[model samples]
Target: MRTDIELDESLMREAMTLTGLKTATAVVEAALRALVEQSQRHRALDKLAGIGWQGDLGVLRDPRSSDPE
Candidate 1:
């Protein structure tokens, strides 16, 4: 968790300014969290994209349908 790596100072400053993060550590942590969340969202969307829907919309929208489940 304490690995040190070189990063662009200007980019770091920009990230700090944009995110209102005071330190490099905060910026890095926030960036990592955003990356993880974005990856999870993309994976969820991919899974949803693979699913197929062939049901009638009118039946779902109707209030008189007997079988709601």
Candidate 2:
């Protein structure tokens, strides 16, 4: 898809410099990918935040130890 859109020159220049990306397309694609991945990670964290663990969490401290039955 080809589209023409106006972008902030200063921000673009800074991104190009910091990323060392030679082309606008590459820089934009990398930025978009990072944005999506970050959003996904945050969503996963939010879901995990609602979960509550029950029982002996101390088992996690020493997996080698066994409980007698």
Candidate 3:
């Protein structure tokens, strides 16, 4: 967790300014968290996309209709 690596100074400064993060570490951590969340959301959307809609909306919306199952 304490590994040191090189990063673009201008990019880091811009990130700090945009995010209002005072330190490089904070900006990096925030970026990592955002990346992880975005990836997870994309994966979830992909999974949902694969499982297409299977039921009729009219039946679902009708209050008097008996249970189809």
Candidate 4:
């Protein structure tokens, strides 16, 4: 896919340097991927937030400390 758009030169250069990407397209794609992944992670966290957890979290951290019944 090809599209024409204007991007901030300073921001683009910074992204390129940080990501070590040689082209504007690569940098843009990488940024898009990161944004999409972050959004997905946020969505998953939000869904999990609505659930009611009843178990003791401490047991998971140290199973040996918990008595086996």
Candidate 5:
């Protein structure tokens, strides 16, 4: 499946430079990777929310026990 879609020159240039990619395919691939990473982070947060984390969830914010790891 191949088709042509117009993209803004500024955006394309920015994406290429930011990703340091030589081809449009590379830029798109990097963008997709970032998207997947972001989605995974969101899913983790959603899972924590679903578990009713409240304030002190697994001592993430608070200090550990007197054992002091």
Candidate 6:
């Protein structure tokens, strides 16, 4: 499929320098891959929920930040 869109020049330059990519398509591909990996990692963490953990307690403040009782 073919598409056209505007993108930041700095990102294009950085992508070329870092990935040796001379086109905007390569940068978009790399960014999409990173986003997918991060999403998968988030899913893995979500799957770990309820395995072992305690409920959150009330908020605690720093001793120095509160007046002494």
Write down the worst ten-residue block by lDDT for model 6: 54-63
Report the lDDT of model 5 for residue 67: 57
Stretches of model 1 off by over 4 angstroms after superposition:
55-69
* Comparing 1 and 6 on lDDT, the stronger one: 1
| Candidate 3 lDDT, 1-69, residue by residue in tens | 998989999999999999999999999999999999999999999888867778999987898787757
Where does candidate 4 stray beyond 4 Å? 56-69
Q: Which 10-residue window in model 3 sums to the lowest lDDT?
A: 60-69
Give the per-residue lDDT digits (tens) of candidate 2, residues 1-69.
Answer: 788978998999999999999988888999999999999999999989969878777776776767756
Error of 6 at 67 (Å): 50
What local lDDT does model 5 show for residue 21? 96
Please provide, for model 5 over 1-69, each residue's C-alpha lDDT reduced to its tens digit, 9 standing for 90 to 100. 465878788998999988789988777778879999999999998878856535655566556533565
Query: In TM-score terms, which candidate is top?
Result: 4
Ranking by TM-score: 4, 1, 3, 2, 6, 5
**Candidate 4 per-residue C-alpha lDDT over 1-69 given as tens digits, one digit per residue, 9 for 90 to 100:** 999999999999998999999999999899899999999999999989968978878877996976889
C-alpha root-mean-square deviation, candidate 6: 7.9
- TM-scores for every predicted model: 0.74, 0.72, 0.73, 0.76, 0.63, 0.64
Q: Write the per-residue lDDT of candidate 1 for residues 8-68, one digit (tens) a residue.
A: 9999999999999999999999999999999999999998995898999998798897575
Steric clash pairs (candidate 4): none
Q: What is the C-alpha lDDT of each candidate?
A: 0.93, 0.89, 0.93, 0.93, 0.79, 0.82
Q: Backbone collision count in every prediction? A: 0, 0, 0, 0, 0, 0
